[model samples]
Target: WFISYALDEYFYFGIFYGMILVFSFYNLIMFIAIRQKQYLYYVLYNLSVGFFEMSTDGIAYQYLWPNAPEWNQVAYAFALCATSIFALLFTRELLFVKAKAPRLNQLIIGVIVIRLIFFIYCYLFNQTLFSFKFIEAIPLSVAFFTGIYIYKNGYQPARFFVLGYSFLFAGFTLKFLIMLGISWLNFGVVSYYSLSFCFVLEMVFLSFAIGDKVRLLKLKKDKAQQKIIKQMAINAKLKDTVNQELETKVEERTREVYHKSLIIESKNQALEEANSLLQKQAEEISRMNVLLEQDNEELQTSVEKVSRDRVMNTEVDFEEFSKIYPDKESCYGFLAELKWSKGYHCRKCNNDHYFSGHILHSRRCSKCGYEESVTTYTIFHNTRIPINKAFYMIFLIYSSKGKISSHKLSELLSIRQSTCWTFGSRIKKVMDERKKTLKKTGKNGWS
Candidate 1:
C-alpha cells in the first residue's frame, strides 16, 4: 500500500510539472507576440504560479510526508512566503487595480519584506518569529479579500484573477483546516489539482480578452476608412457641380459677347452704305458744276465778239429783243425737246401717236386727252420756287456730303429750321423705304 501510494504521488507530480512546462512555453510565446505590459505580467504570473506549485508539491508530500527531510519545515515556510508575494503581484497585475492604489502596493511590499526578514532570522537562530502555522494562513486571507475587492470594482479580467486566487486560497485553507485536526479529503492532492486547473482556465480567459481587444481595434479602423471614402465621394460631387456651373457661366458670357459683335457689325455696314451714297452724290454735283461753268464762259465770249463788231444799233435791238421775248417759250421748248428725245407716248392709251397743243408757255398732249408736261416726272415737278432755287437746294445737299446739320442747311437755304429739319427727315425716311423695297425685290429675283 505504501509503494502504491508512492507511485501515485510520483505520477501526479510528473503530470503537474509537465503541464506547467508546456504552459510556460506557451505563455512565453504569447508574451512575445502581444508585447503588452499586461501580457508580460500574465507571463510572469504564470511562471510564478508554476514555480510555487512545483515547490510546494515537492515539500508538502514528497519531502515532508511519512518522514520529514532535514530542512523540510524551514524550506516549506520560505516557499510559502515566496508564494504569497507571487500571488499578490499576480492578482495586482491581473486586476489592474494596483496602479490606482499606491498604498496597497506599498503595504504588500512591506509585509513581504517583514516576512522575509523574520523568516531569515528564524532560519539562522533555530527560533521561530511568531508561530509558523499561525502566519502561514495569512496570505490566503489577504488573497481572498483582494479578489473580492477586485470583483466588486467591476474589473472584467478580475474574474479569472479572483478564481485563480480562490483556488490557491482554498488549497491553503484546506491544509490549515487539516493541520488543526479537521477530518476532510486529502488536502495535498486536492490543492495541487485545483490550483493547476484554475491557472489553466485563467490563461484561456486572458487569451480570449486579448483577441477581443484586437478585433475591436480592427473594427474601428474599418469604420474610419469608410468615413474617409464617404467624404471623398461628397467632395468629388461638389467639385463636379462647381465645374459645371463655371462652364455654364463662361458659355453665357461668350454668347453675350457674340451678340454684341453682331450688332456692331450691322451698324458698321449701315455707316458704309451711307458713306458710299454721299460719295456718289458729291461726284454728280462736281460734274454738274463743271458743265454750268463751261456754258457761262461760252455765253460771255459770244457777247464780247458782238461788242467788238461795233454794232451799236444791233446791240440796242438785241437788248430790246432780250427784254421783250425773254425766250421763256424757247427755254420750255428746249427742255421738252431734251426730255422727249424718245418719242412721246400717251400714258393712258399706251400709244406713240400723240398731238401737242400749245397753250402760251406750256404744251398739252392730245391723245385720250391726257395733258403732258416736260417737268412732270422730273425733280422740278410741282415746285412753287424758281427752278434755279430748287437746283441750288439740291447742289447744297450734294456738296455737304450728307454731313450738313439740318440747322446749318436751313440757314444756307434761307428756310425755317423746322421746315428744313422736317424735309431732311422725310428725305431720309424715303431713302430708307426705297432701300428696303430694293432689297425685297432683289430677294424675289426682280430688278
Candidate 2:
C-alpha cells in the first residue's frame, strides 16, 4: 500500500509539475510578448508554488537535488516565501486591488511583509509551521476579502478570481486536513492527485476570467461607439433641418426685397418718362423758334422753279438713294415711317385707330373700313410704273440743272416717251399743289 501510494505521489508530482511548468512558461512568454507585469508575476508565482508542492511531496529529494539533502529541508520555505510575494503582486495587478480595495491592498502588503519576516526567522530556527499558519490566516484572508470587495463593487472578472482562488484555498485546506490525519476525506491513494487537479482547475478558471474580461470590455466599447454614431446622425439631421429653415427664411426675405426693388424701379421709370417728355417739349419749342427764323430767310431766297421742285438734290444722290432704298421692302418701310410720323390716322374716316389690311402693308380705318396704302397721296400715288423707276424719274427731273424734256428723260429713265410725259405731268401737278399748300400755310416751300 505504501509502495503504490509513493509511486502515485511521484507520478502525480511529475504530471502536476509538468502542467505548472507549461502554465508558467506560457505566462512568461506572454509577459515577454505583451510586456505586462501581471503575466510575469503570475509566471513566477506558478513556478514557486509548483516548487513548494514538489518539495512537500519529496520529489525534489528524489530527483532535483538528491546530492543536497539540506536543500530539500530549506527548499519548501524558500519556495513558500517566493510564491507568497509573487502571488500577492500578481493578484494586486490582476484585480487592481490598490484602487478598488485600498484597505485590502494594504492588508496584502502587510501579509507579504509578515511572511518575509517569518521566512527569515524560520530559516534561522529551522522551523516552517509559523510561516504556513501565517499564509493561511493573513495572505489568503486578504486575497479572499479583496476578491469579495471587488466582486461586490461590480468588477466583472472578480467573480472568476473568487472562484479560482476558492479552489486553491480548498486544496490547501484539504492537504492541511490530511496532514492532521483526516482519514475519510483523504480518499486514500486518490488524495495524491487531488491537489494537482485543483491547481489545474484554478489556472483554467483564471484564464477564463481574463478572456471574459476582454469580451465584456469589447462589448462595452462597441455599445459606446454605436451610441456615438446614433447621436451624430441625430445631430446631422438637426443641422440639416436648421439649414433648410434658414434657407427658406433667406429665400422669403430675398423675394420681399426683390418686390420692393421692383416697386422702386417702376417709380424710377415713371420719373424718367416724365423727364423725357419735358425735355422733348423743351427741344420742340426751341426747334419751332429756329424754324420760324429760318422761314423768313428761305422766303427771301425762294424762286418759283426751286419752290416747285419735288426732290432736293442736296438731300440725297442716286448713290445714297440706292443705299437707303435697296429693295421694295426698304422703300415701303421708309414711306410708312414718313406717312405715320405723327402716328397712324385714317384720311377717309379721319380716325386715329386702324387695323392692318389683307393686302401687303396696307391699313384700314377701324371706323370706316377704308383701306390706305403707304404710298397713298404721295408722289408715287396711282403709279403705272415700278415705284423705283418713278422715284428715279422724279429725282432726275428735279435734280437736273436745266429742264429735262420727255424724250430725253424717257431715254435716261428707260421708259416710253408718253409714259415719261404723263409721269412728269403728274409730278408737276403734285408739286403745284404742294406749293399752293405751303403758300396757304404762309411758309417757304424751299430752303
Computed on alpha carbons, the lDDT of every model, listed in order, comes to 0.58, 0.74
Worst 10 residues of 2 by lDDT: 302-311
Indicate which candidate wins on lDDT: 2
lDDT of 2 by residue, 1-447 (tens): 989977876676677788898888887887887677878888888888788777877777787999998778788878878877887887898888899888888888888888888888877875756445435546766776788789999998889878988887887788778777888887865575576677788877777666676678789878766765676687688667766765675567557556655754565566567786667655654565566556545543443334344225445555556544445655676678888889988777689998988555778999999999888888787778876667777777656532678998788667899999998988777766776799998974423
Give one clash count per candidate, in the order shown.
0, 0
After TM-score superposition, the amount by which residue 244's alpha carbon in candidate 2 deviates from its true location, in angstroms, is 2.1
Q: What is the lDDT of residue 45 in candidate 1?
A: 56
Identify the runs in model 1 with alpha carbons over 4 angstroms from their true place. Answer: 59-82, 98-155, 185-447
Model 1 C-alpha lDDT per residue in residues 1-447, reported as the tens digit of each score: 999988997787676667656766776787686565555555555566665565556735554354756555455565556656665655555455467556666666676677778777887886565245568456556656766775687645456555655665565566666667776555565553665665566555555554554566678778766765676687688667766765675567557556655754565566567776666655554565566556556655654554433322222332333332234444455467877788777667766665665433344546577777766775556655344334344434443434567787577657777766665554445445665787887742111
Q: For each candidate, give its TM-score against the true structure.
A: 0.43, 0.54
Pairs clashing in candidate 1?
none
The RMSD (Cα, Å) of candidate 2 is: 42.8
Q: Which residue pairs in candidate 2 collide?
A: none
